[model samples]
Each structure stands twice: as C-alpha cells, then as structure tokens.
Target: MTTSFIARTTLAVAAFGALALAGTAALAGDQDFALLNATGYEIGELYVAPAQSSDWQEDVLGQDVLSDGQQANIKFSRDEDTCAWDLKVVYSEDNSSAEWSNVNLCELSAVTIKYDADSGETSAYGQ
Candidate 1:
C-alpha cells in the first residue's frame, strides 16, 4: 500500500479497538467509513448524529486530534441505521467550527471535509 494509505489504515485500526471499547461498539450492518480532514486545521472534536437529532451522539474523536490530511475511520452501531446525518468539526487552535448537514452515510464509505478560505465555506463530499 502507499504510505498515506498505510498511515490511514494504521490510524483506523488503532482507533477501532480503542473506540469500540470506549462504549461505541460496532454492530451488524454498521456504516463503517473513513473521514478525511482536508480542512487545513487540527480537528479537536468531531461529532456525528442523525439528521433529525438535536443533540450529537458524542465526541467520536475522543482524545485524538485529526490533523490536516489525516483520516479516521468512523464506525456506527447497526441500531443507528440512519441514512442522513450531521457532522461537526471543531478546530483545535481557536474552537472555530463548521458543520455539514444531511450527509448520506448509507451510501458512503468515505467522506472528505474541506474548507475554502476565500469563500469562508466548509463542505463535505462522500463516496
């Protein structure tokens, strides 16, 4: 595998075991995926919740910081079973944040979050 792919895989594997033991256990039919941070900031906290939920589930990143270009694997419980979801990323330096709404998690194996300084826009695309 390529170096970057190896790094991402290593991170994913490291996170999977730790996160599963941290009370976010995996389940059948879970929407396992990768979250790529292309936002050029250190992501302090990451939150994911169903589209209709008012509150986020939890800090999925836990104690980890997702630096620019780093990717983390996001695993969910089968009980979640939601197609639409919301994602929020808080930058570590100043707590500045961005949110992406109604992401279709069901069909996505990876989601790339990007920020454009010129437009002051943050968006996500998944595949």
Candidate 2:
C-alpha cells in the first residue's frame, strides 16, 4: 500500500481502538448500593438482575446473612443505557422470598424489604 494510505489506516485503527476502550470503561462504571433488611426477619439470600432477565443472578450475600435492621453493600456493573433492575431476597427461616421489580437504579441508593404479618406478604421498594 502507498505510504499515505498505510499511515491513514493506522491512524484510523488507533482512533477506533481508543473509542472502544472508552465505551468499555463507561459500561464498566462503578455500581453499588445498600440492601436493607427491614422485613422483620433475617435475609438469607439476595439476588439482583437486570429487568429484562428472566432468571435471578447468584446471591450477593453469599454465606452472609443480613439480619433485620441490617444493611449490606452490593456492587455490580450495568450497561450505561440500562437503568432498570430487579431485586430478590429470601427469608432465613422458611425460604420465603420477596422481589422488587423495575427499579430504576439511577434513582435508587438502597433496597428495603418489608413484611406484613397480617397479610403474610413481603414487599420490596427502592429508596
């Protein structure tokens, strides 16, 4: 190839690589939030997933449990264009679970699970 053509091609490739790196960095930007257990019971498992996903991700708590009135830090990365998320938590005693759906992570700093003794139901909300 001509010297000018080769030089132009190399410059273009370098620019492309830089843009790709920038995009990757943006997509991998830090995402972290606190999970509060206010359901009047200990939380055994915590799962988070993108709103579009059908399956819940692995437990964020791992071997740890979030006791009532306790909070745990959860960290993850989401696409820059995606802001919706889902959170699920299971109670320690009976494996009963509660889920909060379509939560906008951009507007949420914490997730709290609430349980009602009268209705025997659990609900979650973002704060």
lDDT tens digits, residue span 14-41, model 2: 2222222211122333436788777678
The number of the candidate with the highest TM-score is 1
Q: 72-104, model 1: which lDDT tens digit per residue?
A: 998775486556666778778767666665565
Per-candidate RMSD, Å: 12.0, 20.0
Which residue ranges in model 1 land beyond 4 Å of their true spot? 1-29
Q: How much lDDT does each candidate structure score?
A: 0.67, 0.61
TM-score of each: 0.73, 0.70
Model 1: per-residue Cα lDDT at residue 65: 93
